[model samples]
Target chain A: MVFSRYNSSHSTAPSAPELPPESYHQPQQQQYQSYYGQPSSIYGQSGGFPAGTQPDVVRAFQMVDRDRSGFIDEHELQQALSSGYQRFNLRTIRLLMFLFKNPYDSLRIGPAEFASLWSCLGHWRAIFERFDRDRSGKIDSMELRDALYSLGYAVPPSVFQVLISKYDNGTGKAGLDFDSFVECGMIVKGLTDKFKEKDKEYRGSATLSYDSFLCMVIPFLVSYD
Target chain B: MVFSRYNSSHSTAPSAPELPPESYHQPQQQQYQSYYGQPSSIYGQSGGFPAGTQPDVVRAFQMVDRDRSGFIDEHELQQALSSGYQRFNLRTIRLLMFLFKNPYDSLRIGPAEFASLWSCLGHWRAIFERFDRDRSGKIDSMELRDALYSLGYAVPPSVFQVLISKYDNGTGKAGLDFDSFVECGMIVKGLTDKFKEKDKEYRGSATLSYDSFLCMVIPFLVSYD
Candidate 1:
């Protein structure tokens, strides 16, 4: 009776064709539309992430904008240079000042104008090497002072401290060392080296080697009797 | 001997020592005497310039002070920068602003301060390298704009021309490239470098490298666009 009763509905059902072994896994083949879902990816991909080789510019900018204003400015720039970028030169500052004027209210430097700015500052490489005393890839406050003295100038601790303090990362540190300051400059200027070469004339022989020059100059610059 | 015939008495006396052999010429030593005349010239004669190695820091400052104003102000500094030097960073502005703030007409950034000050600006190498794209060791207006643009800011042509006009060396170039601009920066900072692995890190990498990142962030800052 049970079998007879079950046959009433069972006999009415239609039987479909069997799927292949591979088809079991391929059930959703039609549903597999596009690729997506990844973080920090590039443009052009099916995913929201960028597909093509978008420059890591976003990340790089983040690194440069030390103050987190979501933008970079002169002070931020000054701070970045003090922090360690040692290449954000003053020459560009001429243009920097020109792009906009009167700091407090105005702050948007346009791209069109910017796109037409100076491209590099190679002289600083030679300059840095001179002050980088120990050559530890940085110039500490002491080194800075010494380097300045080498250039025939003497600086007071008070004034020196004030300058370093402006760029201080609030480490309660008194002043900037060479490396940290250069790093700050780099971030501010967005620097890049285009070539590598020494001044053959100077390197070969000149009035004096840069090192010897520093030795001679720092003492002369010292204001202390 | 023939040209010296006019100075009959001195020429005939033969008091002058023989010149050194062609193989060994101490140009620096000789030039040293030229700037600060030697009391001695030969081994037996002791009238060559004092072999004092100390640099005349006071003289250096005076030279930079061109107008004999007893101090170097922004205008004087601008003149120097236009001459060729780019180490000065925002600190130069700060220094100028400091001098501007001084109530005394006798305000002067003394040598010590300069030593330390240039040391502070020495960190701006990154900014320089970015603008010195060709790596020829300086920057012009186009290069400056490019560097600024890389920092996410741009300088308008009107302003750029005006800025360059401030220090136009009769070049009529309308703008500065890297070398010229850096020289200007150096003059602003007071010309001050030498020691490190030669900032290879600051060189070229076009695709959103550090320089590009910096450019991207510069648009909104204390000054630059």
Candidate 2:
């Protein structure tokens, strides 16, 4: 069956298309430039962030920056992630840096950028809690699958397993903490948006070859390639 | 302000774009013929309907198609809507007919198409119940607004009012029952998907002109135009 093939391929090998790291870095550089040019333009503009949460976001960023350098570098980020929230692998950290609009590949996060990232992360945390119905601090694979579906992505089981494996600890239990949950949500949201682009005729769904699906989801996955 | 203009315009006049009924009827005819030509191809393929719910959908359609005509016309749909579920207006019924792939402009729904529609509605119902938090047999306008946000639509207040007024009972209270809730969900999902298409660059948001918003959501609105 198609799903079984997807499962076998996923289990045996990593799935995302192999791109040079520079290919990943270029667009993010441009995105950061634009974002820095108009930092406040991103959040609260789209009702994604709550009205007064700007202050909260700034405070959160200040607490993470600690050194008063007005920027949170990779080391600071690592400390923040490891101390209180979920622990993320290096690949996930790199993705977060890119997403948080690290300017000119500086690998550091400034206040405006950090505020935007913080607010978005807050939104994702709320979503995570909603789906983490048992208050277990982690969402099991089943909950994660349902969350994706509710967000309008109906991933195959193998694709789902790959998603779970990306975040699950080595303990053999398939679950995702808040950071993993946020990462997964962002990836799914991006991919689902892309799929909807191809489905413009609104024929009710979009069909993609498995290869295309991997291309869309691969960048967010921890790269073993 | 932009919101004030939207609200005043909506209050003073009907908001959906005007098109000849024939214009609305044409593409749906093609869609229905294509759907009927390949009936089962519609449901499970799209990831819209979950696996293993086909039997439940078939049973639901059978129960609704009381005459055993193997098809459900507007009257049968009306019976189904009014008896066990919530009531909907004529315009809403026409929209549902188009969505359900009514065959050859006959305005009658066949088993396969009905099953597909039923399953999608089941998904929407689960969403509705989750937000219907009070279990009061209706979702108030506030709940409806939050539901849309949770579903990733960041609609403005005026747009939300327009949405509420479409389904709210005449008691001056704004709330939606199951059928109305389903109709609203379908419209929002379609619009949000279209918006995401325009937001492909993922600059975090899509900006649609009022005209474009109307063009996308008009067909589903009760057309007093």
Error (Å) of candidate 1 at residue A22 is: 53
Candidate 1 per-residue C-alpha lDDT over A68-155 given as tens digits, one digit per residue, 9 for 90 to 100: 3333444443333333334454433433433222222123221111212211222233455677756766665666555444332233
lDDT of 1: 0.33
The global C-alpha lDDT for each of the candidates, from Candidate 1 onward, is: 0.33, 0.50
Task: Report the Cα lDDT for residue B217, model 1.
Answer: 26
DockQ of 2: 0.01
lDDT per residue for candidate 2 within A154-215, as digits (tens), equals 55654565455434432345677766666665554444344445455444344443223323
TM-score of chain A of 1: 0.26
Specify the highest-lDDT model's number. Answer: 2
Residue B123 miss distance in model 2 (angstroms): 2.5
Clashes per candidate, residues 3 or more apart or on different chains: 120, 0
Off by over 4 Å in 2: A1-225, B1-56, B63-71, B80-89, B102-106, B165-173, B194-218, B221-225
lDDT of 1 by residue, B138-175 (tens): 56656665544443223335434443544444354434
